[model samples]
Target: MWRDEAATWQVAQRSTAEIWHLLANVDVVHGLYYLLMHVLFTCFGPGTTTLRLPSVLATAVAAACVAVIGRRVAGSWAGLAAGLAFGLLPAVQFHLQEGRSYALVAAGAAISTLFLTTVLQRPARTRHWAAYSTTVLLTGLLHWLSLMILAAHLATLLWTRAGRAVLARWAAAAGCAVAGVLPLIVFSRGQSVQVAWIPPLTWHMLIGPAVLLAIGGTCALPDRPRAGRLSAATVGLPLLAVPQLGLIALSLLQPVFLDRYVLYSMLGLALLIGAAVGAAVRAARPRFPTASRWILPVTLAVAMSALLPQSLATRSPASRVDDVLAIASDIRHLKRPGNAVLFVPPLRRDVKSLTPDAFAGLRDIALAVPPEKSGTLRGVETAPDRIRAALLAEQRVLLVTDASPGARPARGARDRMKTAVLHRYFVPVADEQTRGRRVIVYERRSTPR
Candidate 1:
């Protein structure tokens, strides 16, 4: 949760005057998260809570945005219900605290959407065009898929004859997008997902998780028609969100895709679900005050139930940045003067997964290490060759990794590493929990066979 934020904090500490140049010239390679964090850390100070405070605040604001947008598109009653549903969703809260851009993306997407609809309802004018264009531009910078909202806006604009001029403004928006993204395109050329990963996309990787997310979030659509156009919105939000999931499933064919990367569509999905529920209750009884209250409370309860399980489950246990001190602790206890640590399989340059941040259990442990020994890029056992070479030059390695890829580390990576190549390897000193995941302390095999 904090790795992405901490990495950005590295940049935020620079003098504010130098920040713009830093954002433009430096290749943080983190999508646009570094730049956004610059703004957050500027206000909140460079601590973990401060760095991530924006995401938290953004999502809280987003729930209100959803309700406001819902009231406009659905009805006041449906809007209140939708707002509650969005606020209570554990997924919303989960993203809000992280350093990643997903929560902001969700909020930005919602606000932009509301702007789009309001503009469309009235005659086209330069003022509406400018507002719509600005929202579209901001959305583009927030997340990769936030452009989907722009696409949605365009789709909405096209529904009427008045939409032609507003829709045509996309040419200008496209140019701005290009100019904004050109630097990323140039710097990230070699670093794009295509060059970095090995896995191929699978159905489960794409549609499966998104479908589950959607179902978990908004499966509460009501069966009523008077809930003020909710049935249409309920239908439309899914239609917009589904394509992004397909793109994600496709993206797994490349090197990386964080769930945060695809989080923009969730706002629309959440609001629609709320509307669906309100529409249903309203349908059963057109009268507002009596039935409406029950519908929203029920929807919120269900969304909460769905969100809780996912929140507990997906937070990877081995995320190392969160437990760096623990890993360092295990090392300290088992350490001899000469013992050294190795990042197994060597970390990929600028790769989040390639570093100690990957291990949730060892997160604080790694963070607590002295600056010199703390951030070294050594590989844990099953250590990659390059990183291994770095460590072999030293004597010991407090190796770690959950290389199993969604599977826990098997029985003993220390033993396996000893067998695989480091014949002189021994599980002489260490802790082993699930496979290679837990820290292992080792003294080279006492004697070469």
Candidate 2:
């Protein structure tokens, strides 16, 4: 498990009351997902499989929804190709088995889109509108960022010129969903400090979305899409382009442009690819009747073969920045009896919180309150003076921190004090660095009599 998944594990282990209390202070955006994981952990008991199974299933559901939408807008062959394509995309593969809300949010986006396609194709009914509203509400509850999909859907409506009735009904349903999640949106804003670590947007950050749009545009060209038509290009182009462009616009103000936030956009790209394939097969059928039948299957096989290496790499521990599980094992091995531990930046405390068994015999010198009791992700720490005094009293202190390249100098007063006192009074006995984590053992020097 990586740090983010480790967070899910630690939070999900908390009691319902504790989880609710924790949300009151931070991570309210993930409150619903954390609660859902809480129930799963309660029943299944905590393990890697229990933590990640829901995401795997949710991703499968997203792929199935893409296939259904493709079939409706294009054809059976397009549906098969699109569904297969959804599973093969690198971003989708990364989060397919992650223990995070984003996968489930992607599934919800696909389901809501499927419903919208149904309503637009058939006569818009109250039941269909209600289903769309309810799905949108649930998806927003999972992560409000997904509510951006409504913008993509709106662009689809406008592109198709679906008439005033469809537009007004869509407005009503979307209005209801937005109102339902409005409180969460407002409350989560107060806790926006959680995202303060996200760096300012840069030119390099724009490259990924640019490449995606270029590919989607390439696929869309073959469709020769026209307005007022319910086709893949009309649906897929907006779904692919709108959210990404909207996110870029928003990032100019607040810098919240993580790709996982819009992973559902890949559904649009897959649809366009499927539509292009369907178009090719149709154009070639009369000229090469027997060979045309094999185009999609052959294309799919080639895609799978090309992506096999990346798919395997995504499943490996090396793909993530750091492994909490690995670091915990290192702590267990490096620790001696009665050693005191300190985590720089305090957030590194997650390793201990997630795998307390590894830290059972060690003392957390700076922690004033445990996370569950404190109602925070990272527990409250003592003041710098107290932490320094505690460091002075200890014979051996283990400093757990980010290894080089990932490491940043201590910025907080308490963290700086720990570093200063350790250097002044102690000598390094042992240092172990592995997989983006470092543990240094410092033994106090003898004072001359």
Question: Quick one: best lDDT, which candidate?
Answer: 2
362-399 per-residue lDDT for model 1 (tens digits): 22121223222233322133333543344445455555
Give the worst 10-residue stretch by lDDT in candidate 2. Answer: 440-449
Model 2 C-alpha lDDT per residue in residues 153-230, reported as the tens digit of each score: 998999898999999999999999999999999999999888888888899999999999999999988788899998
**lDDT assessment of candidate 1:** 0.53
Give all TM-scores, in the order shown: 0.72, 0.98
Model 2, residue 157: C-alpha shift (Å)? 0.6
Per-model CA lDDT versus the true structure? 0.53, 0.91
Q: For model 1, what is the error of residue 80's alpha carbon versus the real structure, in angstroms, after optimal superposition?
A: 1.9
Candidate 1: where are CA atoms >4 Å away?
Answer: 1-6, 9-31, 89-91, 159-162, 193-195, 206-239, 242-258, 285-289, 305-325, 348-397, 403-421, 425-427, 432-437
The TM-score of predicted model 1 comes to 0.72
